[model samples]
Target: MFQIFTSFFIIYGSKGGCPMTITKKLVPVIIACCLLFSLFLPSVQAQAAAKFSDVDPQRYGWAMDAISFMTDRGILNGYPDNTFKPGNSLTKAEFTAMLYRLFDKYRPNMQEEDADLRLAGYADVPETHWAHKEITAIYDYYFGGIAFAFKEGVEEPFFQPEKKLTRLELAQIMYMAIPFADDAPGASCQVIMGMTDIPYELFSSYEEADEYRFDGRYSEDTGISVDYYVSEGAPVLYPLVLVKESDGSCSSSFDDYSSIIESAVASMHTSGIMTADDSGYFRPHAPVSRAEAVTILNRTYNYLKANRNLQQYSSLETSSAAAGTPVTNPQPEPPAGKPSSTVNPAGNVKTFTRDLAVEGELETMIDTEGYRSITVSIEAKEKVDVIVQLGGKKSFIRHEELPQTIALNGIKQVSLETQKRVFDLLNRDADYTAVLTVELK
Candidate 1:
């Protein structure tokens, strides 16, 4: 069409078949047409590249780019009828297949002779299963001290491939796949434990606390054999602290599962590899849709492509050692005659302020003598997550609840959670700072 139009214009203009005024007008029209054609060419090509029958542009527009990217690379495929069922829930087997394709470079090559030997372990994922190869491949690659999709509490050794994948599970897979620095999981747990809010006087009586006690040995989910207490009176039971054994190691039945989920979700959320919904909530237990799965996988791929130095967790033994190690040492006291930063020296109550950038942190030692309560006011120019650490305890503040005050009943040395390497990788551009005010009463 362009060739014919150009030929007609050339012949008509050269022979004066068209008047100069008309020819001058036609020249601008030709240029305009060329510019418009150039602009639409890519869109046309893109549309032809990955067209799905069921995905409506208005509803699934945000996911179309990701769907297209994955489809083009053959990481995701539409149904035989040419429909991409974006709303359908993603299953474990399906996710493994997608991950196997997405991270092909990271996995080992499986030989036909060795396939049966490697795949023989899973009782449910038989040779007849559709995603047996993918399951085998992913299971062979260990992450966070276990194989892919490894779960506790199963009576028989089986891989439930047809089970719908949850948001938390996907986040965990991505977290393991990226394999943050060696200390990341531990540091993430610290942030989680620190952010947990438990009232100091919740369990007023020993009997009340005893009623919520759980021995770690009895809980098959978390194999740590030790006694610990939880606040069962609350809507959700919150693990308080692990009981210290004669070996000085703390033990608790509150498994690493919750911590890992929290850590994975936090890492994913902060890094923009995956994000929460409009309410700033990452529904960890919610079932993942096919569209959401691909979109997240696409983001993970892009992140990995850009970041080449990411260290993968090598040995399960070493990785396990990185998480749940107890800190048994007593918190050191603040130096005498040294006043707290920005605090009034003469009063029983002390107030101080510190400023920090996104992913930035501040640490200060406060003499908590005669103080029964601690309050922190966070003021940020934009919404941001902040971690406040007091001695061994930590608290996390979400952005939505920002420009607000966080009050804790007990006093501990004031500090902020500082996992610099993890935060640095998560957010590089630290242009703004959140102001935190600490007050002891």
Candidate 2:
């Protein structure tokens, strides 16, 4: 039996006069009634079920729900000592086993043999190994085509069955394995952009007039597009994980990578399939332990199960265009305008003459108004395509030589009050560097 005592006080103030205070105390019977009403309210501690001994209710509180959810579903379990070790590193074999179990747990019937027979033929993977099935399945899914390219003169193929899995490896693997929509990489029908000047006919999709438009590169025999790319003349492809944060603005912390992998990480991070560590780092180069891998896989499993009944695609309506038909290109025409400001490259810039793919982005604030023309001196290793967006207006230019100008009209003036004035140099496909200059009038 508990009691709560509260006193009410009212202050009466008069102009040019002293203030008076009136106080009233509630009856003991009324206090008792209030206490009785509070008895019906749920206790936060009572609602929580004791799941593990080591996972503290205070420190690891964020993961408590995920831990409980996984444990209840039988996807995760503690050690013989009844402690869930969240800090341990994950191994390759353990991860593979977890993945196999996850897919088996969800789509028990869809599991079948992949067409590639040699995938399971890794020398280290014995028929009796626990992860053989999963290793084989994933290997079959990305045969000689994934994140790590295939070498022409390699003596043998290896899955490194017992090796430790790195964070980047985990990201790549989880991304490739998950069954997501076509917008993501490695989907049954993948849409890839950023390649410039290639014939539009190269991109073909199964469904007509699809917004994705282009189908991923496919095999001549299978007629199915696979997720793979060539790096230094080697075919490579890999897997997925991601995290969807509360805020709509999403990004991954693994910044040191090429555009392709960066795009994958960004997609996964935004979709809530993967998350960063406590220090707010992705730890891309760090290895994941067996326990961590199992926990993450379990989380993924629970996500799938919860959303199992929901329709994957909301709209069944589709376009009626042919598969290989070229839709409108993403490039926009230059706007008409006069010069307003002058922008000249000041720092030393290098020109790349090697046969390699390199890319970057430059963001700057523009305070100029009216119509403008941009002039630059540049050379291309193969080709240079520059896309510029000034304020809300955009323009695209393909130049192989310096001392060239493109005019854009219908530009608006920048207001100091408004914070929306922005300019960007989208150097998406520039192999060699160039001396750039922009004039707005």
Candidate 3:
């Protein structure tokens, strides 16, 4: 069993029920402390502006820390548009390539052996892929190839390079693949603890709050965690905090690792994922992103759902009906039908005329009032299937997966549930355009 970094966080228990908790105020003491911590870091605007000392684990996920550590050290970038798809699963080859970049510090000065597919290897992965070089190298070191006595003479060294990397597996692989990962500052690997080889200087204290530094450079002007906020009444907020592996939850503070989490969360707000509420409390520990970071972004674009009930909100405000909205209505699943030869077959497609609006369940919705409500439909040709997504303006509410059949005539459907509040926009450049991932068997 591996004792990796704990994932349990407790960001909210009290003012409960904000899908996302956006921070609005600043603790002066924390602000002052944040300033001093900045002094020790290398002076660079990007680095100074962004550092790991900040992370609201509740709002952001462990990836935020990974991202921050990579970014401050000058690595890993979001799209040219400046968005990080944290939840997308990466392939073994892709990750092996990333490992190469991340561990540039080691400058291993090794070259990749040409992908020798004649040896034992996964049938799906081939040398043609971009990560072929890195993937092959990793197999030689980390995951030894499958050994079968019957084919020993004929079997090639198998590299399951095309496998999808799991989050836990990725963590474990990254644990040792950090190139020449050294202890932070005064850390010495002479000792060992739950995290890995102990860095005596870094781990002298077990509490994150005590061990992490906070300088006054930090400001209240950072991103929020929860993606939405109520227009009136109480401000919907989610707290971001971390805990050891044993703890069950939180909506408020944590015993350790708050500073790093606070910094990471703040940075993630800039990167996206955790948006803000109208009131503002970056509920950093209110668990938001899950599985992979790419999916976190994909959810927003793909109407990718948390797949959990809306009850997860600290404030169970998912009671309002979205039937009044032009875009929402309970849509029964379309009956199975024969292929409409005129149209390409779609994994899923929904077609409706412009004036007709389909129904959907929105965990939450945001309306600017300025723009007229536009009804959009998802269509597909007979050749492929797609996943259509629609969203609300204020909340991170989604009208997920309205598959459409491919054709001149296509059917796209979405399920909406709640009409909620207004949320501050994080990325002005966020791609709001409907996305379609096509898979044809």
Candidate 4:
């Protein structure tokens, strides 16, 4: 275990009775005091103009930033009473409208009303509903492939437009919809609980949050342990926070849906997209208010916009539903019917050398079963961290492992989920050249 930094952001303030204390032993008290001093500075007033009485800029500074970002973009606004009810539960209809607003702002072409929307087929959401257009555009037209909100039934699909959105649902939806920067890789070996020669990457002594476990830790027959690389001067023990991992039992706090919501909660917490309560516990079952939802969306939109790249890799099967993956044209299905010849046909193996963008994706999609093999080779300039998706499964890879060949065995489908591509770049304008080859047998 390495001495990794804790994920929680310390709260500092004296407004609305917000806590001015640090209970977590790992959090340095000096840091909290510095934050307290910064709150009263004159420069912060501009950022604190969130205008919401309920959200104190000194206490919940991040909330203010989120609100300001959204309002400035004309995507969100305060209530008529001049109060942002940050704690009020958000309804499904409202969330849809918020997402549509973002879509309208970014994709101006989607602003027109496509009166021929096929949402009338949904049993619950009728065309006459107030949010029908917004819902149809995002749920039916934009995110039809992912369909995270749809509940399938025997007769037809249903959208619970009136139901309140929960924290778990919000986290899962945001993770699926927005692209976030990946955490930097930490040093491999460090001291864990004063134990020397301990590896940080692989840990078995205890779990951090049960719902979120990365590949760094694993279990052995003798006992649980960690595996990590040995880097000079890196922290040994990574901070492991307490999460629901002891028992697999579901909690009513999640309204009897704990099992399904657990992973999303952990992912959000770990990714810094969502934070825990004062007690450091993520209330997975709590309802997400409209203000909070807008804040999340605002943050997500900014992240996506900042990371957009003009260079993209196509021909690879990529999922439109993947977070932050731009969707323009729908994927065309392969022509029906197998090849007239029963022979196993070989595909054209072509090699091309091009500049790969830092945030770009290299994808290949195969619609014919005749192609059974794919080999890709690249001479990467840097250690680029990328995710490879085959069928529906995903695996993390680095550019260091390139100049290698990948053979698809007993694999019939390939789809790359478009999340953020992590790369070790020297600068913003940096581009790496990779030689790729694709062959089918």
Q: Please identify which of the two predictions, 1 or 4, would achieve the higher TM-score against the true structure.
A: 1
lDDT of 4 by residue, 341-413 (tens): 1112344554444444421233333433545565444455544434444533334444445444556776654
Give the higher-TM-score candidate: 1 or 2.
1
Cα lDDT listed for each candidate:
0.50, 0.39, 0.29, 0.42
Q: List the residue pairs that clash in candidate 1.
A: 194-394, 194-395, 195-394, 195-395, 195-396
Residue 171: error of model 3 in Å?
Answer: 5.5
lDDT of 2: 0.39
Q: Write the per-residue lDDT of candidate 2 for residues 200-253, one digit (tens) a residue.
A: 222122122222222334333332224332233333332211111222211111
- TM-score comparison, 1 vs 3, better candidate: 1
Worst 10 residues of 2 by lDDT: 415-424
Clash count for candidate 4 is 20
lDDT of 3 by residue, 312-349 (tens): 21121224321111112122232223221111333233
Give the winner by lDDT: 1
Per-residue accuracy of model 1 over 1-441 as CA lDDT, tens digit each: 466557756767564475333456576687777777778565522462358778887787767777776776677788898888999998888888988776765453253233322333466677888898777666532232223323344422456678777776677777655633212212333333333232111233334444444433223433321211111131232344322223222222123323344556556665666666655555555789988988887666554333432123121122221111121223434433434332443454443333343112433455454566555555555444445545333344454544444454565455443221121222335334545565666
Model 1: CA > 4 A from native: 1-35, 42-50, 108-120, 140-156, 180-255, 309-441
RMSD of 2: 19.0
* Rank order (by TM-score, best first): 1, 4, 2, 3
